[model samples]
Target: MINSTQVSYFILVAYFDTGALKYLYFMIVMSLYMLIVGANLLLIVVICLNRSLHEPMYLFLCSLFVNELYGSTGLFPFLLLQILSDIHTVSAPFCYLQIFCVHFYGSVQFFTLGVMSYDRYLAICHPLQYHIRMTSSKVAILTAFIWLYSVLATVVMMSLSVPLQRCGNTIEKVYCDNYSIVKLACSDTTVSNIFGLVYIFTVIFGLVILILYTYMRILKVCFSGSKQTRQKAVSTCTPHLASLLSFAFGSFFEIVQGRFNMSRVPIMFRIFLSLYWLTCQPLFTPVLYGLNMSKIRIISKILYLGRRM
Candidate 1:
């Protein structure tokens, strides 16, 4: 049996010949990558530099932006190189590393969003106690927990996959996927499969439920409250809901891409769908939170347009 040590490289089967169009593809992807980096960085800096934005919500946003940059950076540079190269293969070690990063990013994204929802619920539903409950130190502790938990869980999952007896080195995607790697293992992958399912249910589905439940509570408060309360909920929760839905849509397709057969679909469309999961949400979050939230907008204007807050 060919184990992971024997399998030095993995062929990414998603890429097809684009010939001269590769230059066009390269420019497009490079531009997208740059934009993701620029937008996320701008927001991160705005959140960091402004004393007014030192609140819990903005702090959480900074974490979100940083995670976006992390996730995209993990994928895009290598993706750009792969697009231009005639060969679309990655080393086994780097592939596993990419797997770690992508999974960590995803888990953290779900978690941070969940925490942000809880923050909002406190802000709107229990305004008086919000500050006391979610103090700066608490936010720091929570943020640390999110990153640490994701790392420890992902490390355990990777340990299971990396040493397995690999029977193949072909991953039919534009990037490394842990499930794909596990599928290549000649040895049993029952443990990995169970852990993956448990992780998804607890992290992905659990967060979705949390977000939904928090919104439900907020909505109930708004219905009986004054116009100002309703408006506040709309202003604050709209972006969060929009973010959750957009990311969910993208994530659904990604899960499908990994688990289901789509061989009949056109290759180009499949590739775009795969990349969409990582691209759309990163762009959406900065725009939604940065522009849609008035405080961020005012502060961003001050920094970028030389206005005073």
Candidate 2:
């Protein structure tokens, strides 16, 4: 058995022979990737270029769109290449890097969403002081914290994982995950596994609580406040609620897949489950936000129509 040092590459066992359909799959994936990039990038550019969109909410959204690009770029390009290639093997170093990017994407997603929730809470619950609390500098600091925190966490996870001695080099999924890599280790992983659980709970559950609490408070205000306030809350918070639900769906399946034995599930379905968040969330968020947020929708329409500035 080849240990990690000797294992130059990892065989992705999930990919099967699609024969003539490989091209079809490639085309489908490539199109989705392009659409994701275009949609997210459009919103990012719109937010950055237009002075009207320089508010706290739009700024948070800009950070989000940028992350969608970051996450999708990490997965989609590698996926497109794998779809077309006969061999689904990834270099060991590349596998670790993919692990980092995918994890980093998720970490940032949850953290950003948590912050977005707080932003909404401020807007709805304390509209009078929303600007006072979420000043431009504060938004910049929060945005920086989101990325920086995710980086430090991902880096720590990667550092622990990279030194492990692998007993095998086969990963059962189309992509590499830290857990899957840990399962292959020939060395002791007690410390790694423990840290992994702590890391996951600290990030996931903690942020989940924050999101839940923020929305709860926001809801309380909407109920007791004026009609206009209720309308404002609904219009502003609907997209965020949808986004959280969408991500929760993907995240649930991901957790189930990662922690449980899922051989009874259909292979195609399982594959879809794995790809749900990485593919669907990235594609879903921009579309959801773009269509739902009127200001963004109008600007996007204007840009698409080539209207004069």
Candidate 3:
């Protein structure tokens, strides 16, 4: 029986032999990490400084931007260091910590999006009651619930896996993932597998359904209303929908990579698919929201001009 203390570290075997391009890879990844941080932080700061943007929608956006930073922070620093270093290994505890952070990021993201969807639903479908229903206090509670719920879920999942006897010390992915680590266990993982699947379906599909239902109702209302209503719906909902689709696609690709045999695919493409959710969503979400939402755009422009002056 391999005890937890016996396993010092696990090897990460995701990077390819980019003999001469390692430097380029490091620089590219570093630049992307910087961009993700800078863009998300800028939006967060802008939202905080401008009291006009303190409504439920913007508050939810702030939560999302913060999660983007949180999620990327979990992976980017370690990834950059691994890209530069020859040996890609992470200590067991740090690996589990990474798993917690990454999964926590994912859970909070879905919950936050669900909350955003609910906010939109109330704002559009119940306009008269919107303000009263989604008060500042309520919004804060909901956001807090999202983070807390996610943390609890991740902790439960990690606890289920921590006691399993690990037979191997190698992870095949770029970062420590719960599923990847669980696969290393020598003991039977049927319970963990079942729990993970249940958790995935319950959380991912449930949120996806909630989002779709809200949009469908919104669409119905928009169609029955005036042209202005339709345009307003399109402008506001497009970013969220786009963001949803982006996250779904990235997540889908990741799931496929994990479940299917990827031996036939190009190594680089596999790498891209594996890191897509972490990389693209954080980088593009702020851009999408910042550009598409009129209030945010105006505020961003004002901040930019003020900085120049």
Candidate 4:
């Protein structure tokens, strides 16, 4: 029986045995990674430099962009290295680190979205009190709480897994996840599994429910209001909803893929599904927000034209 202390590395068996196409796979992943970084950084930079965007909403968006970068960085660099190398092994410490970062990204993301939804709710439903309700200090505190809460949650999850007696060093995924790591434990993982499920439901589903309730209220207020008010509400809320749905789809698919036997699914499709959230959400967010938000679009145009000049 092997223990956690004896395990030095985990072999990842999720890569495609692409034979001659490995180079192609590498190039594709590299390209996507570059795009994700570039898009996210651009959003972050634009938000930072533009004085007009230094509000609670843009500040939250900046945090979201940064989270996207953090999440992708945790996975992409390691994945790229694995693609070029023959060995798919990751050191246990690094695996746990990756687990922390990826999960932190997810938790922070949902929390940030929840904050954004609440921001919208206040701005739309309680227009007169919006400024007082979402003051800069309050927003800053909320953002800090989002990050710190995520870190605490991830730390607890990782700490729970560290004491388990690991029997195997093989993970069947391209990246490290808590579930995959816990599944390798030799001893009973009932506590970890139960806690994990409860954590997921309480965090992810709780945020989802909060978002739904907030949006529902916003919708109700929009319907009872005037034409211009409806347009304003829709314009402001569309990007948030789009981002929410995009993330939800990716998360849902990844969870389903992880929990079920996907043997019948085509290998390429399976791979895509597994990585869809990490790859797509980071790219989807900036593009959706930059294009949909009029102020952001205008600022982006100015930046583009300035670079051209």
How would you order the candidates by TM-score, starting with the best? 2, 1, 3, 4
The collision pairs in model 1 are none
Compared with the true structure, all predictions reach lDDT values of 0.90, 0.89, 0.88, 0.89
How well does candidate 2 match the true structure in TM-score terms? Answer: 0.96
TM-score of each: 0.96, 0.96, 0.96, 0.95
Off by over 4 Å in 2: 307-309
List model 3 lDDT by residue over 240-283, tens digit each. Answer: 88887888898888878877788889888988888988889899
Residue lDDT tens for model 1, 133-210: 999999999999999999999899999889999888999899998889988888988888888889778777788788
Per-residue accuracy of model 2 over 1-309 as CA lDDT, tens digit each: 656689899999989999999999999999999999998999999999899999999998988888889999999999989999999999988998899999999888888888999999988888799899999999999999999989999999888888898888888899998888888888988888888789768877888889989998988998899999999999889888888888889989988898799889988999999999888888988888888888998888888788655
Off by over 4 Å in 1: 307-309
Prediction RMSDs, each to the true structure: 1.8, 1.5, 1.4, 1.4
lDDT of 4 by residue, 190-254 (tens): 88888888986887778878898999999999899999999999888898899988888888998
- Looking at model 2, residue 240 earns an lDDT score of 84
| Candidate 3 lDDT trough over 10 residues, lowest sum | 1-10
Q: Give the range of the ten consecutive residues with the poorest summed lDDT in model 1.
A: 300-309
